[model samples]
Target chain A: MVFTTTKFELLTNKVAASFGLPDARIVTVDHPLGGTDRATIERWADAAVDTVVALLTSG
Target chain B: MADKGELLEIVDASPEAVMDYFDDRGWGDGLPLVPPTVERVEAMLAACGGADPDEVLSVLPPRFGECTRRMVAINAVLAGCRPDVMPVLVTAARALGHPELNLRGVNATTHPVAPLLIVHGDIATSAGYNSGLGAFGPGNRANATTGRAVRFLLLHVAGARPGPGDASTQGQPAKYSYCVAENTAASPWESYPRSVGVDAPSAITLHCGENPHNFHDMEADHPGPILEKAASVMATLGVNNAPIGQGEYFVGLGPEHAATIASHNWTRRDVQSYLYERARLPAGLYRKQFGSLAWFPWMHEVPDDHLMPATGHPDHFKIFVVGGAGKHSCVVPSWGMTKSVTLAVAP
Candidate 1:
C-alpha cells in the first residue's frame, strides 16, 4: 500500500510473490495511499467507503 | 431493560478513534475505514455462501502476501459493496488471474488503461449492469460497485497503491471502475465470449481501454466505407497502431453503426477484415519525422522510410460490437504500446 504510480509490474509481482499467488491474478488500479503499507491500505478502504457512503447517503 | 448474558464490554469510541486504529496500523489504503462491525461482516460472508473469509485466493507477489476472502470482504464493506454483489467481485478477481491477461504487467505499467470489465449473459441484466445508453457513465449500483470492488481489492488486498505499486502515467478515470455489459440484445453479432471462444450462460470479460475516442460518421451507412473511415481513425497518426508487438484493439460498434454493416450483409468477420486492411498506414508515413516511429523500429533505421508495416500483425485488431443505437462508434486505443491481454470471465 501507499505506492507510487507506474510500477504495475513491480507491484504486481510484489503482491503476487508476497501472497504466493501468481502475478496474473492481480490488477492494480490507480489509487494513491500516503504512508506505510498497513496504514495506507486502511486509508484506501476508508476513502473508498466514504465515496460509497456519500453516494448512498445522498441517494 | 437489556439483559446482558456474557455481554461484551461497551466503551464509547469516536468514529475517528476507530478509523485511527485501522489507519495507523497501515491496514488500509490511507483512507479511514468503517469498522468491520460483526453484523456487517457477517452479512458480507453470507453473500458468498458463508465461506471462510481467510481462505487464500492467492499469495500476491513482489511483496509476498496472502489475499483471503475475509480480507476482500473487509475491503468490499469499505468499498460500499452489498453482500449480494460479492459473487461478481470474486469472479472478476479470479478472472484477473488468467494467464493470458498479464495482470502483473497491467498492474505495474504506467499505462492509463486499466482492466475494462464487460459482463455478458443473464448475469448482466440480473445484476443491473448497464449495456445501454450511458453504459460507460455512472448510476447503476451493480456496474459501479462491482468495478469499485475490484479497485478496492487491488489497493487494499493486493496493495498496488499509487506512487507505491501502481505507476499509471496520466492515470485514467476508468481506474475507479471500468465495468460494463455487452448490449447483446442490440448487437447483431453473437456474445463476445462466444466470439473469443467461451461457453455462455453469462460471464465477465476483461480488456484494457485507454481513453476512448469517438468516430462519428453520419454521412455514410454502408459498412465498407464506414469501416474504412473508422479504421483510418484507429490507425491514424496519434491514435492508430500503438501495439508494440502483437496487440489487440477494442472496437465498440454501436447498434446504428453495426446495423449499417448488417444492412450491407457483412458478418462481423467481414467487417474485421475490411477494417484490418484499411487500418494500415501508407508505407511513406512510417518515417522518423512522423510519429509512427514510436512502434516501428525500422522507421528509424530507414530514416525517411514509409514502407515498414505499422502493426506487427493484421490480426492485432480485435472487435466487440456494443453500445446503444447511433451512427457513432468508437475505438478504445490501447494504452500500452502493445496489445492487451484478454481473459475469460469466471463464475
Candidate 2:
C-alpha cells in the first residue's frame, strides 16, 4: 500500500501504475504536508489506518 | 568521427537565429549555448581517445533515456566545454549512474538538492578548474562548462525537467551549475580521492548536496573551537540531516582552518570523529521541531533529553580541505538518502 499527498497524486499514480498496483492499494492525503499541526497528522494517520483496514478486510 | 545521428540545418541563419531555434525547441538551458555543429561534436568525440561513441554510459530515469558517449559529446559541445573536460563529465555521469547514489529519487523528490561535482587530483590544475579564491563562484571555464554539460544531460537525457519530474519547491542556485575541485596543494591532509583509495591522476565524486552554508570562525585558532563552529551549523534543525537522522555530510575546510586544525595534531579521522561526537541534536529538540511523527522506528530508542548523532556513523562525515586564503569554511548538507560515489576519470 502507498500513502502520499494529494499534490503528489499525479506522480504517485504514475508510480503505482508502473508497479501495477490497483487503485484500492493507494491512499492519498492532502497536499503540502508542511505546517500541519500534530492533531492533523494524527487525524490523517487514523484515517489512513482505517482505509488500510477496510481495503484488506473487504477482500 | 561523429556517430550517425539525425542532423539539422539552420539554412544560412545568423547566430541569434540558431540560438532562437534551440530555445524554441526547449533544447537550451535558458542560457546562450554554443551551437553543436558536427565539427565541434566530432572534436569532442576525438578527445575521448577512440572510445566507442555508441558505448552506453547509463540509462537516465524519469524518461529513462539511454545516454551514450556520442550524446554526451553533443551536450558537452552545446555547453561550451573544451574537449579535455569530456572525460570529467563522463566520469561524473557514471558516478551518478551508480545505484547507491539514487539519482532517480534525487531527480523526483521535492528536496532542494543537486549533484555537486567534486574533482580531486592533478587534473583539476591541468584543466584549470578554480580551487582558489572564488572557487565556487563563476569565471572559470572548466568548472562552469563541465557542470553545465551534466545539467543538460539530466534535462535532455535523464528527463528531469522541472515540474514534471524535478519537483524541487525552491531549488538553489547550485542547480544551475555546481562543480568545484579540491585545493589539494594547500590541504593539510591527503587529497579526498586518495583518502577514498583512488590513486588516479583525476577522479570525480558526485555528491547529492544543497548550497554550502558558510560556517565562519576567524577568531578560533584552536581546532576544538573551530569544530564547535562546524557542529553548530551541522546540527541546525532546518537541514535535512537533523530530522532524517542518517546521511553523509561534507565539511569543506579552508586552507588556513585546515592548517590550524592540523597544528593541534589531528588527523582527518580525528576531525571526523570529533564532528560526529559534537554534531548532534537533543531528542527533545528534535521532537519540538518535528513532533511525534518525526520519529523513525529504526532510530535508537533514546530519551527526550538524550543527544542523537546527526549521521548514522562517524565515517559518514566526509571532511575535505578546500578554498583559498580564509578562515571561512562551509557545511554541505546532503539530500539524505544518497551516498557519494567517486570514479576515476577515463584517459
Candidate 3:
C-alpha cells in the first residue's frame, strides 16, 4: 500500500499510475507529517492501518 | 548525414517557424533557442576529442534515458552554446551521473533545489564564465548556455519534466540555468579543485542547491565577526540544512571579505572550522522546529542537551572565495542526502 499527504495526492496518483497500481493500493495522510507530536503521528498511523490491512489481506 | 536519432522533416517557411515548432513540442526552456542544424550539431561533436558520438555517457533518471555524446551536443547546440563549451558541459553531465550525488532523488523530489554548476580553474576564464560582478546573473553566454544545456538534457533526455517526474512545487529562477565560475584570481586560496587535491587545470562541481541567500555585513572587518554573521544565516531553522542535518553547505565570499579574512592569517580550513563550531541548532530547538517524528536515527546519537551542527562535519562546509568586489557574501544550502560531486573537464 502507498501512503502520502493531501498536497502530494496528485504526485502520488501519477506515480501510482506509472507503476500500474490503482487508487485502491494507495493511502494518503495529512498535508505535512513534520512538526506534529507523537500522538498526532500515532493517530495518522492508526488512520492508515485499516486501509493498509485491508489492502494486504484482500486476494 | 543525419545522426542515429530519427530524422524529422520540419517544413517551416522561416527560422521563427522552426523555433515555434520546437517550442510547441515542449522542448524548450521558454527561451529563444539557436536552431540545432545538422552542421551545428557536428561542430559540437567535433569538440568531443574523438569520443564516440554514440557512446553512452550516463543513464539519467526517472525515465533512465541513456545520454550519449551526440545527444548532449544536440542539446548544447540548442541551448546556444559555443562549440568550445562542449567539454565543460560533458564534465558537468558526468558529475551529475555520480552515484553519491543522488541524481534520482534530486531529479524526482518535490524539493526546490537545482543543480548548481560551479566551474573552477583555467577553463573558467577560457570559457568566458562570469566569476566577477553579477556572476550568478545574466550577461555571460558561457555561464548561461552551459547550464541551460544541462537542463535541456534533464528535460528531453532524462525525462525530468515538471509535474510528473520533477515534483518541484515552486521552482526558483535557477532552474532555468544556474552556472558560475570561481573568481580564482581574486581569491586568497588556491582554486577549489586544487585545494581539494585534484591536480586538474579545470573542473566542474555539481551541487544540488537552492538560490543564494545573501548575507550582508558592512561592519565586520575582522574574519571572526564576519564568520559570526555568516554562522547566523547558516543556522536558520527553515533551511534544509537545519532540518535535515546531513549535507554540505556552500559559502561564497566576496573578494573584499576574503582579503579581510586572509589579512587575519586565516586559511580556508580555518573558516570552515569556525563556521562548523558556531553554525548549530540546539536539540530542543530542532525538536521545536521539526518535531520528534522528523528526527533521524543519527540525531539520537547526539546528546539530547547538545547543539547539533548544521552538517555532518567541518569539512561539509564547502567554503570558496568568489565574486569580483563587495562586502557581501552568500550562503547556499544543499538538497539533503545528496553530496556535491566534482569531475575534471576533459580536453
Best of the candidates, TM-score: 3
Q: 1 or 3: which has the higher DockQ?
A: 3
* Cα RMSD to the true fold for all candidates: 13.0, 3.8, 3.3
- For candidate 2, write residues B47-75 as lDDT tens digits: 88998887878877766667778889889
True contacts kept of each: 0.57, 0.00, 0.19
DockQ of each candidate's interface versus the true one? Answer: 0.25, 0.23, 0.32
Q: All models: lDDT?
A: 0.63, 0.83, 0.82
Worst ten-residue run, lDDT, model 2 chain B?
B291-300
Candidate structures ordered by DockQ, highest first? 3, 1, 2
Off by over 4 Å in 3: A4-59, B1-4, B13-15, B292-305
Stretch of 10 with least lDDT, candidate 1 chain B: B1-10
